[model samples]
Target: MQHLSRRQFAKAAFWLPTLALAGPAWAQTGDDPVEFVESQYNNIYIYKRGTQVSMTFGHNKRLYTESVMDTTDTKALPVEYTKFMTAAVAYTKKQDSILQIGLGGGRTSWYLHVHLPDAAIDVAEIDPVVIDLAKKYFAVKEEKNFAPVAMDGRLFLLRNPAKRYDLICIDAYRGPFVPFHLLTKEFYVKVAEHLTEGGIVAQNVEPSTMVFNAAVATMKSVFRQVDFFPAAGNVVLVAYNDAERLSDAELLKRAEALQAKYAFRYPLTDLVKGRREPSNPVKGQILTDDFAPVETLHAIERKNEKWK
Candidate 1:
């Protein structure tokens, strides 16, 4: 057996439990079929088990599931975090235009596209391979209103100065960690610049990471109201420039209205109930492009954990 370093061990420990929790029913069977496997920006693996298809990226034992979809029922969002991400709709009454930083299996985008047929959806996926896989296996299709561009999210935002969105979702992840550039305060400023009035940004953040507090702090520095929806092993952050924070009653009312209109597979009302108070006096420093040490923070967090 190859000797694993402490970091490797910690990463394995972190992912193993999540795999057990988030993985499809076939995960325990050990008979899942590999639909595709390739190496590019990351080692990518696609698995198909029954009606479920999943995309995972990583090297060796450090694998992380990026996206999962139920092929038989596209609206049935299998991942808990994706369901939480849909809660972003409650924050904005008009989703005329939406910008999603990462495509993943295109589950979230597809769900939104189905429910908000009038909305124009733009997806930025840095990896063309993932986009191709999403179309080939995940039932993702590009139509007149839906556009998936092959480009880095930050570059896409930088290049399109005039484009604004009613909602912006930052679910980009390289394995379990967000890209360093995407986590910085500067990157968030660019994200905020692209939002239309009353627009909101929803991000999927892994709270287990040491940079979690810093990520929240960075968003607080840029946006006036930051709300949290904690899901299994992840937290979905809803941040906007509103002067007054929406009360639970208000959010619940919006959620009820959305639910009545769309009747989403995952109830928006249940997701809204997951919302909790933000951490007061967030502990970490605001992450700037010049000083965001995300990898270092992850290492420190792992080092502090008591490994059995």
Candidate 2:
């Protein structure tokens, strides 16, 4: 494991995702039309392009995508980062239960519910409109097995009495920036409490911003092992409860079995191979509840990326 100092990590690393390779027009897999809009802290919208539907924040860019034709969460899997989230399966023998912090289009939660109907799945989405849109347009069914809790991600972790899950995923996005509360070291500590033995917590991180390195560092502070999968404009961090890291061969062995059983479109074999170790961030530089300059970092990253 390469343990670079905080300063070294910041110097060597870039931030997280914009899915630059993924625009409705770029993918050409959709006939995008504005379906619903709610303007607030984040300009949330549900866009429809042919049978393809997506969740967009702030702009027309598809942050979370889905397809009405194939509601299995496969057709809607437009971004590689979303595919990378599923790599958490490599850490477990069975997907007993899952807790997702964000419910963008409800694709991740929906996929688990569909694939593992017998398993319990809970989703924490702060936006009620996003939840409504998930059902109305995105075809995310309201199933008894899948619970959609309208609450903040951090609060859900702190308050929820059910303190264990086989897998946990965090993908909260506020406009183009991440919620500071959700990116803190304290937040990850709460996440760690909920993880069962051999459990995995996978997060979608955008590396095109300054928060990327700090975010990974915060996660590293709590979890014994952290691994990553590089996706288009993003990186998926998979932190494990176990101290020992799984080799690529072992992860692939589990990936192959799960793939055979589920016949997943995004192969776990491919995702498991992109595993990267985490590096430490500088002291006091990592995000915390009291001080997380997420908006500021995002602004800097946007300018640095030359994104208007």
Candidate 3:
């Protein structure tokens, strides 16, 4: 028996299917589609083609397409920073139930699982292939407390109501865009209805795109306080339905408290508040299941590539 690296197998498998479609394209078995395997705190799959490279990470027992860098909860707070600690402590200390929409690289969720040993995690993912790859390469199945469901995220939330979550994380997207159904104000309302009082919903969104504004507006329409914070090139949307004030001062205080306990690189003191884009000049439209022009944002992202 020969030991084959996960990348080797994935390249062979992906190329084989692709060649079959193109009527016998390149079939060199040794051709490496994967650029490299990055294993630090988390396992990263870097696949290459011509000039374009795609990065993937395993989370919640699933393989998710990722941006080139580790953008985890950076939008909310740095993974090595105390912002996450403050967010977790602020929202989830009292509840044991957490629901996650997308499992990407398992970075944020993995931290949550490790920190909250007693919490019940429910994950919703639609792609079975991603799940299979994650189990084999990403150590997703090792998360014993996680329960994964193969279904549309919005549909799952609408159908299931057995247990209410204290913290809801929405990070699901289709390629470079989030599903339209998941971006509507009604969707936020449903997420709110499913939460325990004072519960907060945190979402990781790309700020270079209009989807960020749409998501924020939707969250504001439903939640009492909709705030956005920058982490690298992404933004984390934090929405609290209660009248609690997450002012800069309050957030900083919590970040300091968490730093004393976690000791992360670049304390929360380094985080700069992100200003909401001027939606006043540009009329914003509601993203609906019927008419979400998410693909349009891809064009915008391409033009703004220099900004990233």
lDDT of each: 0.80, 0.68, 0.56
Question: Can you give the TM-score per candidate against the true fold?
Answer: 0.87, 0.79, 0.65
lDDT of 1 by residue, 81-164 (tens): 788899999889687999999998898988999988889999999999989889988899989778999888999999999999
Instruction: Determine which window of 10 residues in candidate 1 has minimal summed lDDT.
Output: 1-10
- The lDDT of model 1 is 0.80
lDDT, candidate 2, at 233: 60
Ten consecutive residues with minimal summed lDDT in candidate 3?
73-82
Q: How close is each model in CA RMSD to the real structure?
A: 5.2, 8.3, 10.3
Tens digit per residue, CA lDDT, model 2, 53-87: 55556443433332222333344455556667888
User: 284, model 1: CA deviation in Å?
Assistant: 1.2
Q: Which runs of model 1 end up more than 4 angstroms from their true locations?
A: 1-33, 278-281, 302-308
At residue 142, give the lDDT of candidate 3: 52
How accurate locally is residue 262 in candidate 1, as Cα lDDT from 0 to 100? 82
